[model samples]
Target chain A: MFPPRSQRILLAVLAASALLSAVSGRLNPYFLDVALGAGISVVLASSLNLINGFTGQFSLGHAGFMAVGAYASAMLTTTLAPRLGLSANLLQWVFFPLSLVAGGLLAALAGVAVGAPSLRLKGDYLAIVTLGFGEIIKVVLQNVDAVGASRGLTGIPSHTNFFWVFGSAAVTVYVVWALLNSTYGRGFLAVADDEVAAEAMGLNTTGYKITAFVVGAFFAGVAGGLYAHLKGYLNPGGFSFDKSIEIVVMVILGGMGRHSGVVVAALLLTVLTESLRQTGAFRMIVYSVLLIVLMLTRPQGLFVWPLWSKKEGRP
Target chain B: MNRSVSGPRSRRSFLTLAACSAVLAGCREKDGDTGAQAIRLGLFGALSGSEAGLGQYTDMGATLALEEVNAAGGVLGRRLEMVREDNRTMAGESATAVKKLLSRDQVVAVIGDGNSGRCLEAGPLCQAAGVPMVSPAATNPKVTEIGDCIFRVCFTDPFQGAVMARFARETLHLSKVGLLVDASAPYSLGLASVFRERFAAEGGTVVSEQRFSGGDKDFRAQLTALKSAGIEAVFAPSYYHSGGLILRQARDLGFDGPMLGSDGWEAPELLEVAGRTAEGSYFPVHFSPENTDPLVAGFLDRFRRRFGKPPTGVSALAFDTLQLIADALRRAGSAEPPAIRAALASTREFQGITGRISMDSGRNARKPAVIIGVRDGAFRFLRVVDPGDPGRASS
Candidate 1:
């Protein structure tokens, strides 16, 4: 197995090279575009795993965070990037990272606000709350006139590249992985395993749960920001309930607690969805069948084993 | 006992090996690339979801165009290849499809994003990457406003709104109008704005304006408000799916007033959805494809032969847009973005199934809008409004 640090560094280098190649027009623009999409999905799926897998929260409002990120990043880049009068090269470097962070921060704030009340609930109630939150975000966004409301925000400078997308995904994975391996991560797992026991253990269960929720939302928001720039447009429809479910599906299918599982699932699912398009009208039916079959055959998911599985009987 | 243990162990190993071989074989077969040399054009639409009919019809239209273009030695001696991607009516998926089309397929251009919101999301990426996109049916002005690289064949909401307004004032001779709009839809909101602005300008009063969401099935509250306002004509600018439900519900609620809408009511399903209530409703469309013009007749004949049904307004617009792109390519003599944009901007008097096509300063098609009224469960052409007489009363 590769060292975690070196694996991350290697991934970063590969992503940087891809971005450079794309901007220089040396790489196939189409492949670069697909890479960017896969990268964004990786960010979304992995972040959502933190809440659904590690914290054992059943939130389905991933798209709400994405919307927050998209709108926030769009407003920042469009409103602030121009005033700064930064050179094109500098703007490319600075605004991309700034938008990602802004998106994450705004999403985190939204997560905290939503999670404060909903986190206290359990099972279907929490799911309903998160689903409702996602719908509310879409509805509120549809009416906010400053960002063009239902008409959507246009004329966003297209600065999202392969590097920006994969780099952010890498950072999200690293952060989430590191957090999962630390005391906070243990607290999250404990809450997931048994909330009552976790609280009995003197752990601030609510605090840990909320932290995971916020962090997960933050990464989702960052992915949304990357998506907005990559598409060069922002619309509420992009962050609808259907989108939230897609991310959740990714996390579940990748095996909730497994990091590489999420990554592989994101890539495989993305490719499968695209390939299924060639099957004409029956594609969706076939996809649904496949999902059902997979569930029945492999209930624990394809990659159920966590990369850093604790030594047997140690816990 | 030892022999028995060896036999069981060998059987287990054999099964595992067979499963591995099966997986490997499946992967290899699926990974094979059937290489074809053609200019791959990506088509994104809600192909397999709630809006499957819309996407299927669009695919048919695009396929017809692609087949015809290829039959004629293709564009620039290369066959036109269509790489279809289903958005499932989700904007995020649409964006992802756009990326895949641009990066993986290396498509020359993209066509047929039926929904306005999806187009709005995907248009910018195309513009940024300098890949020309021609949306056949996305009518919201915001889609093209993204950049110069984006072009749409269909008229914007402003044009359709004016058409509906003219029909209401002149053809229907209704001075008092009620606007029942889907506030959640960019298309509906835009049309409502323009229709209200132009109707009032033409010495008509928008007596009542009621709002509803896209998924709203019941407009009883809004209709009740309109009924109290004593409006003679109702303008409901929304997609046929929702418009049919509203019309059916309104008729059930004793609304007998003439209803007017934009091209969103151009689906055949409208008749089935609204039943007899949809009759007498007027809507403006880009084309009917039922015209007697030889070129249009030829297209309709070919479309019927291929798809076994009459094409809707969207299908015609999509077909025309593809043709327009081909025409522009011929005129520009190159597939480069700047050349094509310049060629597209200078387009004038180009005969399209819709009408004599031209471009205004806003890069919108400057073609005449055709008003079609539902008569006997079929679209009957009422009149065609020219761009010259913007204020000509239909009567």
Candidate 2:
């Protein structure tokens, strides 16, 4: 059980994010870019942790939900926001945040569409279904001329600063933490532990799985919206199967079910990537080697054991 | 289950926060010192990803120009310093790279984003900062439309597509053509669409249009579809990797008329992979090393002497782009970005290795496209087709 201090934690996170965003203008732009990248990774990995780590569902289409959110928010902010008759200052606060929320809602809808049928299947079958869904989203985005087709959507006003990115990240962490600690959230653990037994106990395992998928996908969409504004452009290729694998890797490397461990892993991996920029052409080779060594050494997750007290009746 | 209250958990969280700040502090230490009097010029590209060749070639070309300019008393009495960043070929990475070049490195002008997708990501930032960005070979028309500060030395897709269509219709005398487009690439699709419309407008019929994704090795199926459609020539708008295989496969199918392609088909692999079957294939190229122009000869010699390898068309365009920047810098008489942009926009009849270049109203180079014919595993120059007179392609 979590302490009755969720409201205080939320306020602290918001204050810290706003303070960082205020002074971030004076930071080295390269460091700021890398930090923003790390914040986005934390959002993505934590949301994915909800499904794969806590709910025991192997959903591989996080990037698809992300692309849906990115494009939706990109279109809203770029095309629809200009027509809303709001002043520039009002548009920044109103249209931008609303568009991000709209993007998250649309991605949640996509999550329901994917989870309703696929939740019946388990393990590799669910993984395959989600993988196919991700590909389908990419190909559809590639062909839809309304969204610029293969040329990609550009001219998205850059609305994502440190406050927006880290603020969303903090909110994501709080929501996932708060939800998982609630009594109703115990069904997710039961389903993840033993699906048949959870159903035998009348726990409605499918409903729990669907809930995890919807919440995880909503955050992933917000992450995508932040990403589109960060880069000011969206190419379908950017949300390919490779991107999905990246988020999955972060989750697995972070000790899946643990939120704090996932955040550290996301930040470490992001910093590692930016540091390897000095290695020139061999950076990828070195990066893969480091990952292989990490996996070989810390199979249970990098920041798992000894960092937290061992739970009862668990390894 | 005894749930211990959080003592170590808070410590671990504090450690994570400390590690994050340490990383940020370490990044701050890397703020390098540039030469006091050097005019820094930046280039960002996919130097370490699948598209690494584009970046490497651009760097070599730009460095050669930098050497020559510095040797000739430099521009504005200051040596031109080349600062390059690897974008890793991703759009998001490219934005960060461009931002670093602008804010961290403080380069006066940015150059050499060979891929259009990456350039689009970098273009808006450069435009917003009032910094001139001269792309060497990103041929998408939308690149320059970002703003007046964005310029490209290479011809756009529409120009090359129109040139190939005219060549197929007038020179090759082909009325019915079949198209094999690479659907995965925007370049291929853009070129294919333009060629389709222009060929039709030229009174030539597009008999069949088939699609294949990039990295698909076999094209016999699409070639068969086109061959059976009773087409006189095959128009495969793709890069040299698949372009070569398409040519060889069409020949194997005994349907060799004259294969017409765009500038994407200019790599040496087109002749090597297609082998003897590559003969009679024509493609529009930015530069042909076989040209007898003194500018072309001088560029080839200098590039070979420095990089110790023959230059590709991409390198030639990159060489022209950097030289154009240096020319603009000298003409502007100041190293300021806005002045350089103004000077670049006013460029007219500046002879580059590729050809005489002039910046049009759109900040695109208004230059001729060179047509190259393949014969015996070598690229041969055919004619120069100017934009004004598409019909007058004189050798």
Tens digit of lDDT per residue, candidate 2, span A1-315? Answer: 664565566677778888988898898777888888888988999999999988889989999999999999999998888887898777767788899999999999999999999899999999999999999999999889889877778999888888888888888888887787778887888888889899999998989999999999999999999999989998898888888988888888877677776777788888887777667567778989999998888887776565465552224
Span of 10 residues, lowest total lDDT, candidate 2 chain A: A306-315
Cα distance off (Å), candidate 2, residue B283:
2.2
lDDT of candidate 2 over B211-232, digit per residue (tens): 9998899999999999999999
In terms of lDDT, the poorest run of 10 residues in model 1 chain B is B1-10
- Clashing pairs in model 1? A29-B103, A30-B102, A30-B103, A30-B104, A31-B103
i-RMSD of all predictions? 11.5, 3.5
Evaluate residue B148 in candidate 1 and report its C-alpha lDDT on the 0 to 100 scale.
Answer: 78
Q: Against the true structure, whose TM-score is highest?
A: 2
TM-score of chain A of each: 0.90, 0.96
Clashing pairs in 2: none
Candidates' C-alpha lDDT: 0.77, 0.85
